[model samples]
Target: MQLIKPFRKLVVSVLLIGSSIFSVSSAIAQESSVESRILVNVDVIYPVNYLKEEFKKISSNPTQADVVQIGGQLNFSTIPDIQAIRFSRSFIYDPFANDYYNNRNVGGSDFNYSDQASTSNPFLSATFTERKGNPPLTLSFNSSGSNPPALAYNGTSCKDNDGCVLMHYGYSEEITSRNALTPSLFKTILKLRDNNGNLVSMINAMATPIVTSSSGGVTQYLIAYHEQSDPANNGVLMGVWTEIPVASGISSNSMLLQKQLKDIVQNQSQSPRLSYSNSSNSKITISNTRYFLSSTQIPLDQLSRTSLPPTDSRFMPLPNADGTISPGETTKPVIIAQTQSAKKAMTWVINNKVDVNGETYVQARYDSKTNPYSGDTSVDQTLSLLCIRKSPELTSNPIPEIAKGTTYTNSWSGGEVFAIPEVVGNSLLSEQNADNKCQEEGQKRYSLSGFRMAEFHDGIQPSGFGFYAKSTDPNLSISNVRYWVKINDQNANPWSK
Candidate 1:
């Protein structure tokens, strides 16, 4: 049995009834007040003293294992009309070296490593005993010391070091209005483990008669110590863990790692969903569609790089000051500069590409001030343009196949050509009338109004022609519509009279 002892004594005294008659009376009167104060002070002071002595014992050596453990007792009593008395015995352990290392004594003598292992345990313990005839009270204990070492490590035994293990004992008591004792008990165990699930060190502690009551008052005791194991030459280390033996009302096995992981995965899978549509083109657009796919649908990393191409060159890149248009630069002028007609000026910057699951859409507006309308201010007005990157067959079917001098008519919905008219003026009346008449004719015809017939080519070109209608008298409504046209001719005037 390795035993370490710690003994402490405290004496409190109150004088009463001296030899002189007058002096004895004065002593008795002072006794009660003085004794009461001493009792209160002692209850607080005893625990503090116990902790302080423990610290001093631990700090005196290089390691906790250096101290010896001897079971000792704490004695408490109240002196007659004077003060309270209290004392405790300390338990200590011996220390042992884990390995031999080079060292020198105080005289600077060099000592080589030795194989002789020293067996010493430095752990200490203290005991408490209550003397009869004192008030019942509660006491608490805490540990204080230099910083302890880390309990766990990822590396091998020799690579990482061990941490300190501190043990503490404390008591609590509940007293009724009648001042009777109600005792409670508690115990705690703490262990430190590494990431690999290996226990590195541990601490076991307990407290008894935690709660008690008495006529005088409530009294309690505290004991605590620190212990460190011999460093392992095998390169293993320790970590921190906690255990409560007497958790009177706590539920067992309430927290687990599997449940926590399941919650995390579920939350990530049910993230917010989004949908999109290209209303201007009557096409469905989807943004972030890749996020909706299962892992088997496609490689997760490649989804972010996917994109759709532009519908047409109507939203083509603009040359910068350096004659180079970098990606992501907007070609359209700002709203402040375009003023009341900002919508028309904004067409050039619209992204014609539709993402089936994206949150954006494409729109086109003609800038009348520029091109084709040159020198024709009265004929200038912004027009909504529709351009689609359809298959070649769709483009060929819409081309007009009539002789230049032949009169033909056609009727078609704006949806057929993906075109919607936004604005029209009286100057384009003849062109608008011809476009409407063609629609009624059940035939779509090409109109060559503002351009020379000689400029017509087999490839695509802006026909400078479209359809329009005025609202009825009651509604005062107007329908301005437009579409692309392919024309083949034999030298007849394409402009309508």
Candidate 2:
């Protein structure tokens, strides 16, 4: 079996007791860019003693992967314009190369902790029995330091004051050798009645190192996240993550390369980059955009991308410790940004340029009320990816015009408690408790939802300038409204008002 869970399947969770201040050594969102979502690997750790010893070992001659020399990695997005949260000290690590996961001599020699060694994190016990009896479940992730590692946050899609909700940790589906070592705590992560593995938030249990043959006073493993998440599942093993992979020497100062990295991600080329903050008092001003859906009987009512867009488009990117973006192998699709007054709480993605029925339409899905961890799903508005469309606005502007017709609408009684936005014609989606059961109920359905992450647009196939919504009400009923309109469903035409 692989030393770590496949990045795309599932993860671990536990409440962390740590602190952090921003510094960059690391990694952002845009079209083709996957938002960095944090995942936990509780099984990895790095003893401080190991670092000190390694530092000493390399004092005479440094190996290529020397950590004291090279720094940790960052979690950057694909788009140049969008920025990822930077952690100067956050670098990626490897299990095979560094052997941080299972602490021991580089040659695989098992060792013991110092006679006066401190116990590892409590959750360490939940996954292992290496020491027999140590405090289990103690989540002191870089606790109370001005520079504790940051778990990941997209900086958008949050309420006035609430940063995006973090759900990085998850439990293993079945106990493996790591957790099996301590079967007693393993059950806690299983399907217990009240507390299951699915609930623990190991947002910061980034590293958890065990005793290895290498003599060291402290060992703190580096943890990195791939672009994978299973909200409906449980926690990642106790561990650590780094933005840059340590297949070779990793600097402790690579955090100094923020601007150069940001410059490489030219996402701001098309639309203006929107800024969002965590302060509830901090209000965002969305530029002019329109989205309307009016009956031919009411031609005056229209929907335009110019009028409104998805409310919020900010969330942490997929935790790609390797720093891959733009359709990363493990990265999830990007989240669409909004340019309107009301913020969208649910998430939206372009499923198809047009529907399976082969009409000139776009489709997507969103299920915010239930499990948001089911890849490509969002719970809050902080998404920073581009939406999918058929053509760039330059060539395909002015999509085929549909004569105004009677408005068709329907309602679902069991609507989402947290009104999510599913782009028009989208279907492959999951609700909180409604796994694989996404549905719509209307005669001539046109429930266009999801975000528009692209910085620019060309009225064309897949690319649309039309109606989508984020119901202001909790029930997701249409009564609370945000309707949009555009010039005949394409880029703004001379005819559009």
Compared with the true structure, what per-residue lDDT tens digits does model 1 show for residues 1-497?
Answer: 01111111112321222211111123322321211111000000112232233444434212222111111211111111112211111111111111101111111111111111111311112322222233211112222322222122221111332322222222211111111011111112222222223332222221111111112221211110111111221111111111101111112221221122222112221121111111111111111111111111111111101111111111122111011111112111101110111111112111122222322222222233222222222212433323222234434343232112122111111112223243222112222332432232222222111121111121232342221111111111122322222223321111211
Off by over 4 Å in 2: 1-40, 43-55, 58-360, 363-398, 402-497
lDDT of each: 0.19, 0.20
Global Cα lDDT for candidate 2: 0.20
Show the lowest summed lDDT stretch of 10 residues, model 2: 296-305
Q: lDDT winner among the candidates?
A: 2
- Our tally of clashes for model 1 stands at 66
Q: Write the per-residue lDDT of candidate 2 for residues 67-144, one digit (tens) a residue.
A: 111111112121222222211113212111221211222221111111110112212221211122321211212324
